[model samples]
Target: MSVLQRVVKPTTHKGKKILLKKEPQLIEGPKKTIFFKGRKTSDKIRHVLKDMYDLKKPDGVMLTKRNDITIFEDVTPVENFCRKHESSLFVMGSHSKKRPNNIVIGRTFNYALLDMIELNVEAYEGLKAFESSKILLGVKPCLVFNGPLWEESDELKHLKSIFIDFFHRESVNAVRLQGIEHSISFNAMPDGRICLRSYKIALKKSGCRIPRVELEEIGPRIDFTLRRTKLPTPELMKDACTKPKELRVTKKKNISTDNLGSTHGRIHMGKQNINSIQTRKMKGLKKTAQERKIERTAKRKALTESNELIKKKKVHDD
Candidate 1:
């Protein structure tokens, strides 16, 4: 009898969960420092920070503690943090004695800020999933505040409508809000680091209404009217070419020879006229006979010449 050994292989059961461990990579904070400066002291800054934190609430706000702010350090990190958390709304609050209370509301993508101003909820929901899902991509909204309070004006209503239409179209996602000290002066900051200062708010509103008049119809209408006018036809052209000019006739009276009682002059004229008529008739008859005689002579000469040439040739041959 041979001894047989049986071995069991471990098998994974269906629906069993497997755990995988991922190693964490340490990332260093920005080497540069960021400082938030305003005309007011840091006490006002702290107050503004608190207000912003309260407004943002549950999402929790990320603030740079450094005294100096840089493009690579402060702005970049805030943008990155917003993207990592998939934050839909961003509020920027700055306190300065020159411009006491100011807030900026905006939206962002993972890569670039949209050029237009947008509301918070609308901006986030409107972002394209494929673009926003990328790593390390940051975007911000264009700032909308300048001059006066944006919410108070008719221009605000128009601008809001335009923004809503644009957002529904998913055309843009970033904006910035700025604060200015003067009532007439304001600043608008967009994501591209561009700023418009002391811009007139009324001017922006004046352009809001869509132009009602249509320019496209003008060209076709003019063309149609022009086509209706009568063009010159061939008949009209022929008539113009063949029309006769007017003739002006002037009548003149001459002294009569009969009134002078000259019988000799009259008799002389009658004889001359009779003689001229007879001469013309005789010349016509003479010309016809001469022409016939010339034709007969030419025929006779041609026959005699041909006979002589023939005889000469025969004699030479002999």
Candidate 2:
């Protein structure tokens, strides 16, 4: 006696699909002996069968002829036919020269073999060599083999659209976007000195114009440059407003007294000595207001006394 096992879709048989409750496990224990029976053996089918059973060519399942039923060499053609019709079928049998027995044929509705093949093709093309090797070595493949995540998900798609819009919006030339305007202001002083100031200003996109001026030409000139907008310190303003001291030039009158020889000579020498002393005192007194005022008062008193002495001496001589 012999037993047969098959896997198939459910729709063709009008039954619910056999959902794999758990992943299939490798068969354990002492290998149970089994045999294959068909009218003929095919190298292609034999190779696939060997791979499935993890068997070397010399130690694979045996194939023998049977007379009870006809057998096909490969089941791939039948599988393809089922896929085209949106159906599925599976068949298994034990064979002998006298009669074939223990035959099992099944149909399914859920499994889409064509879809599985397409998915495998995409994964094989997409996965890196290391990942593909792991899968070939019996590791479960992850979502890394799937297509672009942004193309597949709605949220990512929306984000991508927004990013594109932000980067690709209409652009304007940097020069044209900001306009330019020039201005000059002039102020005339009481002494007919005109202060002419020129500024090179930049108008920003926000409609604000900032003035930039040259500071070197700020002194007395017909066409002077404006200074930067920094406010002057109080000390600097005070220094500017304070007037400079006026330069004073003193006049000396030369006296020619004619007593012809001795008296006038003595007087002339005495007057020179007095003038020298007064000049020294005036030079020393220049820094103090009180000292300068007292010196001027003494000069006026000396002049009045000399005039009185000259009038008395003239009346006595008369």
Highest TM-score: give the candidate number: 1
Model 2: residues >4 Å from true position, as ranges?
1-37, 52-68, 71-138, 141-318
Highest-lDDT candidate: 1
Q: What are the Cα lDDT values of the candidates?
A: 0.33, 0.32
Question: 1-318, model 1: which lDDT tens digit per residue?
Answer: 995857433356432322111111132111111123322334434444453343223434455443232222235554564555545334443444443433333333332232113121101111122232211112122224453434554434334433332222113334322211111111222331212211111112335564232111100000000000112245543543342334323333442345656533222233356545645456555557777799889999999999999999999999
lDDT of 2 at 35: 30
The lowest-lDDT stretch of 10 consecutive residues in candidate 2 is 115-124
The superposed Cα distance between candidate 1 and the true structure at residue 252, in angstroms, equals: 99
Q: How close to the true structure is residue 185 of candidate 1, measured as C-alpha lDDT? A: 17
Runs in model 1 lying further than 4 Å from the true structure: 1-41, 62-64, 70-77, 95-102, 115-318
